[model samples]
Target: MSTKPQVSVAIQWATEADHPPFSELSNAQIRRWVRACFADSADITIRMVGETEGRQLNNDFRGKDYATNVLTFPMEMPSLGADSGLPTFMADIVLCTAVVDKEAKEQGKKPLDHFAHLVVHGCLHAQGYVHELESQASLMENKEIEILKRFRISNPYVLEGTK
Candidate 1:
């Protein structure tokens, strides 16, 4: 009786930077995080990289000079042709391990918890969700909050230990 969207998730750890073999960043956990955000089936690849590579990608693609916590690149929409039940959604979500860890400490949040939020945030962007406007941002944040609750994670925008 599961209505979750089916996704083909591939995890890639392109940067070793001491990010080895952690249960929090396991494939199952990543898949669950993405599934929680998707309304339709998707083919997603999540990659973790060091700050250098992250900065390079950001500068090359987005014209930014700094590494970010998460970056999502949505691929071209494919045809849902006859006899093709495969998902048309395709995207690659990249997490900069150093940046994420740094942000987690700065924000007083657990690294894994922040990772979950970023994954969900990136997934939503891949699905065409945006926070460029106030209303849209509110809607997206609310969606993220609800999704996080399923994993017993608190509202990310709210300070921990306060309500």
Candidate 2:
């Protein structure tokens, strides 16, 4: 039997974009990605925001002055809770629609595919996966490739003419 965790995803759209369909960003898809990366059940909230909010949050929290594609905020919870049987992992993933669109176009990637990759990347971050070091980055990227493959998406790190 699979030991994948149960996932509860909450989506918040703070932008007025009619491009990417809702079905592409459904809870089931997000849950599947989370389950693939994490062994513990997770409660994750994905917030889609505009450039302004994304920039502000990035600057305030990460000290970066630009609006990135996705920002992850993992919530650490105490392990002493004995009541609820819900997942212990929790996180808030912020996706900047404008940045995602722009990067997708620049990278010659489909918006849905880019979004899927970012969501999976952010979910991995929530599970304490980081790419600060070369070894860590390789491990994380391999995991991402494996997960995206299941969704029939190509490796996101591959550039045009390099494959």
Candidate 3:
């Protein structure tokens, strides 16, 4: 009677960095983090990339100029109706490992902990979560905190001085 959602995740590592080695960020670890966020069955691909690919994707799709920590590309609406019993949500979650490592160091957080946060964040985006508005951002941030708490992780939104 585990309450976890049925999420099928495919992990691809395209990064050449060694900050967080394969042993530190395994596919099972990624899948576990993403699965914790889903309330419905999902199909997700988690791709780890380097700065070049990350920057290119950000420029081409999001029109940004630098590599970001994570980008989620949710698939279009499925042709099959919701009643078809297929996966209800689908997306590709891209994580720039180098950026993630740097951010984690700057934030005074563990790399693996930060990785979990990004994976969960990206998965939520796949399920149509957004943080563009203050209200929406609050809700999304709270949800992330709640989910992360299940694994004994602290709130990512909290500033260093608060804790």
Candidate 4:
């Protein structure tokens, strides 16, 4: 029997460009990030889309005009009054494939590595990691570094200063 939590990953490409196996890697990355943060059970969804859809989502929800790397929509925590048998529903993470690939090339990083980092980032966001403040940003970055280290990836911050 499988012990992994039920996770739904949907890929939606608004453009004609074919991409890598993002869905499979995203699911594994999210599960790893979630396990690092929370011990309790979880259910989550991840979606990958093209620039047009990404821009639309960003404009509709975040009031941003351009497409972003990732966007996370977290679910409300279950209340005490709710059924105890219910599992934690974390959130949805929408990734922009165009943005991810472009940024990776510009940053001189492998596309797969960049995608893995962003997947971890989105998963962290679902687990309440935010960059609205310096402290939160530090916490999130540190966690990301730790998590990425296990996968043999270098620290993401090292590339930021040169770029």
Q: Identify the candidate with maximal TM-score.
A: 3
TM-score of 4: 0.78
Query: How would you order the candidates by TM-score, starting with the best?
Result: 3, 1, 2, 4
- What's the CA error at residue 64 for candidate 1, in Å? 0.7
For model 3, the superposed segments whose C-alpha errors exceed 4 Å read 1-4, 15-18, 21-23
Off-target runs (Cα >4 Å) in candidate 1 are 1-4, 20-24, 79-83, 161-163
RMSD of 3: 2.0
**Root-mean-square deviation of Cα positions for candidate 4 versus the true structure, in angstroms:** 4.1
Worst lDDT run of 10 residues, candidate 2, spans 15-24
Cα-based TM-score, every candidate:
0.89, 0.87, 0.91, 0.78
Scanning candidate 1 in windows of ten residues, the lowest lDDT window is 15-24
C-alpha RMSD values across all candidates: 2.3, 2.4, 2.0, 4.1
Error of 1 at 77 (Å): 0.7
lDDT measured at residue 144 in model 2 versus the true structure, 0 to 100: 94
The residue-by-residue lDDT of candidate 2 on 7-27, one tens digit each, is 788878775533454335665
